[model samples]
Target: MQLVRWGILSTAKIGTQKVIPAMQQSDLCEVLAIASRNQATADEAATKLGVPRAYGSYEALLADPDIDAVYNPLPNHLHVPWSIRALDAGKHVLCEKPIGLSAAEGEKLLATASRHPELKVMEAFMYRHHPQWQAAKRLVEDEEIGALRAIQVAFSYYNVDPKNVRNVAEIGGGGLMDIGCYCISLARFLFDTEPKKVCGLVENDPNFGTDRLASAILDFGTGQASFVCSTQMVPYQRVNVFGTEGRIEIEIPFNAPPDLPCRIWHEKEGATNEVVLDVCDQYTVQCDLFSSAILNDTPVPTPLSDAVANMRVIEAIRASASSGKWV
Candidate 1:
């Protein structure tokens, strides 16, 4: 099997602590190098993650002729710029979620990708690769829940660190960009289409100047999806899909633990059935799928256009919040 040689663009915690390790376990991925602004930091991360090479500058990593792809886990503001650079350097790109600071920025990356027909570009929404989500989608499509009518999601965590990237405002730090994007993506994913309209309510933290709490209702015509996400609330995450005759509840939807069996409850006609999935690391699944696409000349699981669409929803929700009207 030919493994894709991957170079990580940063030592971001999500990559070093979760994604890189998971990719290391993949048969289709080889984490060849890691890069950082500082040589020492890059070296430390490369050694810690067992990557073979370390580069002080992102440009150096991008210039590596052996690298087939780049995993960009940079901050929200840098996602597009670096991903575009990777594409220009002749490498496929798997960028972190909330693809860019706004829909316009995501479109820029999409445009750059279009100019490079040979390269694959994808926004990493790792949760979608989890089997639990796949099962949930199957159940919805199979109508085990009888025509899907609604989806309610609640994802939150208490965080107030002023210096944290998620708390900063200028560089696209906020609950919506950081976590709420997942909620919007979920609605589009389950519905298999874009929302007709959306209304949102946001509460910004005075100190951080970033939204600490947000709730939105996405009108999907056939059904509706509502979600509330917070950065200053109890740590919890869940999703419930309701239909005319039944419903499905995902027990740990977003952060599905790799070590524990995941479960989804299906209730119909007052009878509940539990569907349990074997332990699996979603990141590993995500890595292999992206790698396979690169090796096989196949489409990525999620396209650059989808990333732009998700960003448009996010922008609309913010617009709705400000204008006090559906958008």
Candidate 2:
């Protein structure tokens, strides 16, 4: 089996502490190098993670001829620009989501991607690759939950450090962009369509100028999805899917632990059935799938258009919050 050589763009916690380790475990992925703005930082990360090479700059990593793909876990503002650079350098890109700061920015990346038909690009929404989600999708399709009617998601964590990237408003740090995007993405994923309209309520932090609490209702024509996300609450995450006859509840939806079994509950006729999925790293599954697509010249599981669509919903929700009307 040919492994796709991967270069990481940053030592961001998600990459170094989570994604990089999982990618290292994948049969189809090779963590060839990692880059940071500072050579010493890059070198330290490389030494710690067992990556083969360390580059002082992202450009140097992208310029490597042996690197077949790039995993971009840069800040929200840098996602599009760096991914475009990687594409221009003839490397496939797997960028972390919300793909860009806005829908227009995402569209710009889409145009860049269109110009490179030979290369593949994908937004890293790893939760979608998990078997537990796949099982939930199948149950909904199989009518085990009757007719899908609504989805309610509550994702929150407590973090108020002013220096934390998530608290900075200038570079796309907010509850919505950070964790709420998952709610929007999963709703669209399960509904298998974009929302017709959306209404939102956001509460921004006075000091940080970023949203600390947000709630929204997405009208998906056939059904509705509602979600609330927070940056200053007890750390909790869950997703519930409701139907005419029954409901399905996902436990620990977004941050499923790789070492523990994941479970979802199906309720019908006053009885609940618990379904548990075997342990697996979603990050490994996601990276391997993208690498396989590149090696086999196949379409990515989630397209760039999906990222743009999800961004539009996010923008619309913000607009609705400001205008006090559904958008």
Candidate 3:
């Protein structure tokens, strides 16, 4: 099989910490090139990650004829513009989430994506593609957790630094945009529908003038979902699904490694079972999927449309938080 050549748009921390490593681990993927604004940084990342080529600028890497896709790990503010640029350059783009700061922002990007039927553009919500997540969806659909009625998810990590993007307001910074998005996305995924209502709260960071913590409640028609997302708490996360008959619990749901699964707790009819699964490096799985999609003309499952709904809920949450009322 011819490998799908990948060109990373930036040498960002996430590229080093998770994405690049995952790409290197996948057989169908090849890290052909990486670009940093400065050639030296690009060269350093290329050398460290064993990528064959490095470019001094984003434009140069996008123009590489051999590169079929671009993995955009750029900052939140750069995601939309860079992703459209990648698509315009005739390269498929797998962008990191949240794809945009607001629903309209996502819509604009989707408009650009509409022009590129030949190219795929998607947000990199790796968890959605993980096997365990597949299992979770199956379990819910199979009636293991019959008649889903509620979902509770939390994704939070302490962000003591005010200068980082997570705590800045100007560059689309806030806990909601940075990480709460995972909770918002996952809830809707399990429900398999857009939320009907969104209401949320936030704890402010005086130093940065950004929301350090955010929590939201969503009504999904048959079930109600509540999520607490933060950049100001001790690290904590969970994704729990409840039905009429039983419930399944995931201890570390959102950012779980595909190899290290969130434990599942099923309880019903006076019986309880504990399931421990291993699902680590979903990022690699995602990279492999993107690579194969581009190389084989296969449809990429998680496209911009998948993320637009999530962003709409996020926008509503921000609105709810600001207005101190339901949205």
Candidate 1 residues 1-327, lDDT tens each?
799999999899999999999998999999999999999999999888789999999999999999999999999999999999999999999999989999999999989999999999999999999999999899889998899899999999999999999999998999999999999998899999999999999999999899999999999999999999999999999999999999999999999998899999999999999999999999999999999999999999988899999999999999999999999
Residue 261's lDDT within candidate 2 is 98
**Pick by lDDT: which candidate is best?**
2
Flag clash pairs in model 3. 257-279, 257-280, 258-279, 258-280, 258-281, 259-279, 259-280
TM-scores for every predicted model:
0.99, 0.99, 0.96
Candidate 2 local lDDT, 140-223, one digit each (tens) = 988888899999999999998999989999999999999999999999999998999999999999999999999999999999
Clashing pairs in 2: none
| Model 2 residue 58 distance off true place after TM-score fit, in angstroms | 0.6
- Scored against the true structure, residue 190 in model 2 reaches a CA lDDT of 92
- Evaluate all candidate structures by whole-model CA lDDT and list the values in order: 0.95, 0.96, 0.85
Error of 1 at 28 (Å): 0.4
After TM-score superposition, the amount by which residue 32's alpha carbon in candidate 2 deviates from its true location, in angstroms, is 0.4
